[model samples]
Target: MDWSKSKSIFIIVFLILDIFLYSLYLNRHTEAQKVEVLGEKTIEARLKDDNITYTTLPNIELAPYISGSVKHFTNEEMQAFNNHEVLIENETKIIVTLDQPVPITDVEDPASYVDFLQTYIIDGTSYGLWEIDKTNQSATFFQRINNRTIYYNNHGMVKVYWNANNEIYQYEQTLLLDLVEFEEKEELWSPIQVIQVLYSRGLLKPDSQITLVKLGYSTLVQFTQTQVFVPTWEIRVINSSGQQEEYFVNAVEGKVIDVQFDQSKVEEDEE
Candidate 1:
């Protein structure tokens, strides 16, 4: 009966609905912007607020993904080693117990042990000393690719145990073979960005001291005998109570990495 009036009413109703929907969208968008801005706080400011202290961050800019298979010992290679009981596990690992424990003049110095490693380990120079656990009387060396460490990859590591006399008695070694770097290098996240990730995730506690920050590679994908590694940042922090912790961040993906190793498996392997 009143077609023109009814059409106008319908238009007004639709117009009001459109405005209401647009308002909602605008509010959500604004809120998101605010969240992002707040989240992107300056690294220094955030650290200062938490009483977390750090020295200069490393200036690593880019890195490439790398892949390699575990080194399989050949009969010739096995024979080349001297003066110890050697066990080859599936041709992928070398376990050596010294014929007589070799005394390290100064366990704290690399020079005291570097010669022993060179004389016994395959490609010993490729490994860098990672840690010396005095409580356990052990030293760990991790393999390096392109002068950067392959952080704690079982496929490429050396662990030596010392006897009560501070002499190295036995060692377990595994190496990666034919490591190939991808030609496509990716720009890595800034060190601060990675640290920020840890802070936001509550991994970095207040009143902690950031003692060390370094670039390395952690396992991104592991196969039966091979692994793919991505650039990662390993940060060491000392809490107020004097306890130390290590955390990792994926430099390429800008996310935290779980640094916990399968301790049970390691113990089982040692047995």
Candidate 2:
């Protein structure tokens, strides 16, 4: 054997192997550190962008079924769930804050004075004041009540008056100066008013007919028509007695339109 040739070959092979191992180690270390840095940056960016100000932790508890399903969920589904959770938490916080005590101010004759408040104040709730505007010769009320800062004409009905806020500890008469004259009562039936009248008169019963005698006719029919914008139907009801009667009633408004008796039918039934 040639000792010099063998020794040279062994040295060359060992050097080659050492270089390969060193390269592998360096590559592995670089990859591991790169992943760690990327992960940390991603977390920091998320926290900054979230913009959550509350210090309290969310009270959401994962249901067993949902947790199990999430284990196999896709990336999109997971992202969507996280977004929903964030939205829900934000909404809850907003609702809680809304329930806190908010200062409310009633401006006299809000329709006229709202402009003044909007021009001067930056924040707070301003309500319309109901007052007789002598200049306009009509009952005017202000409308902008919920933190309105802009001034505009014909924004809402005249706030002529408001009852006391029952919830508040102190009671105050919310009044505004009357710059305009009060107009004569105009006959207009709002939806709520119409419903209230029907309910109060016991005319809104379903699947039944109410017969208004002459008394019912005068009280229910024309008055309801003039008040509400709907027509009334006149229905004639015959009792078990041998007497026929006719009645006029408003079907929709639940008011008695007219009532008359079928005298012939009543006689026949009696026979």
Candidate 3:
């Protein structure tokens, strides 16, 4: 009766459905291509272009934490090598490599990374969380004292490194096992105030741009068995030449730590 009419109608409906599906596939493909091309990018930053006056800050001294009480341990006792491929050379040093023969994802959260470190990389010692720099997939831990975080980049801290393959390839740990709290709370200076001090001292150029204003502990006192650490604000400024320079201000004492101080400390660390 109407068989020919029915066949034509069916073919037309299927054609419309196929076109709709093709449109959806194309949209998804375009989005995927965009993400692939853009990749992961960092946020650009610049320094403030404003007039400022720097005033000297009164210095406040801090007593050393756990002065003269250095705990000694063999390399074997220090590194937590529980079925993990690792190398330990001293009490305050550890290096571990990825044991699994598979891809590992870059760890974003600092808390979770610390836990992994504690279980697989560290042994018999606990640490305080400071910050995680995701660009390099590196995690830096500090010594928590009296509610203030002290970041001794080389002398008394643990830094973990992840490779491009997202594998936990290497990590360096040097922590103060015995940290005593200060009697009084520390008075920290704001980043803006520190920036002004740097500008007035001719340390920061007027045309220089600041990339980051971070607060952490400066490198530890070198060669002192009983080393002390101070709270510091780090100003990362990019010059007009596109060179990045890091300026450290003693948060409590109001002075610059300088790059030489850090370089010397890092050179001294065996790990």
lDDT for each candidate structure = 0.76, 0.26, 0.52
Local accuracy of candidate 3 as per-residue lDDT tens digits, 12-125? 544553563365456543422322121242111213334222223334333322221234446556354555566655554555565663233546755456446556534313
- Cα RMSD for candidate 2? 37.8
RMSD of candidates 1 onward, in order: 17.2, 37.8, 26.1
Best by lDDT: 1
**What's the best-to-worst order under TM-score?**
1, 3, 2
User: Candidate 1, which segments miss by more than 4 Å at Cα?
Assistant: 1-41, 260-271
- What ranking emerges by lDDT with the best candidate at the front? 1, 3, 2
Q: What is candidate 1's CA lDDT for residue 106?
A: 79
Candidate 1 residue lDDT tens string, 169-265: 9999999986878766767878887677667556788899999999988876665655677788889999999998987776765656674431101
- Show where candidate 2 strays beyond 4 Å: 1-112, 120-125, 133-271
- Of candidate 2, the 10-residue stretch with the lowest lDDT total is 62-71
Clashes of each: 0, 37, 2
RMSD of 1: 17.2
Off by over 4 Å in 3: 1-71, 75-80, 101-103, 107-115, 123-149, 161-164, 185-193, 207-214, 219-224, 238-244, 259-271
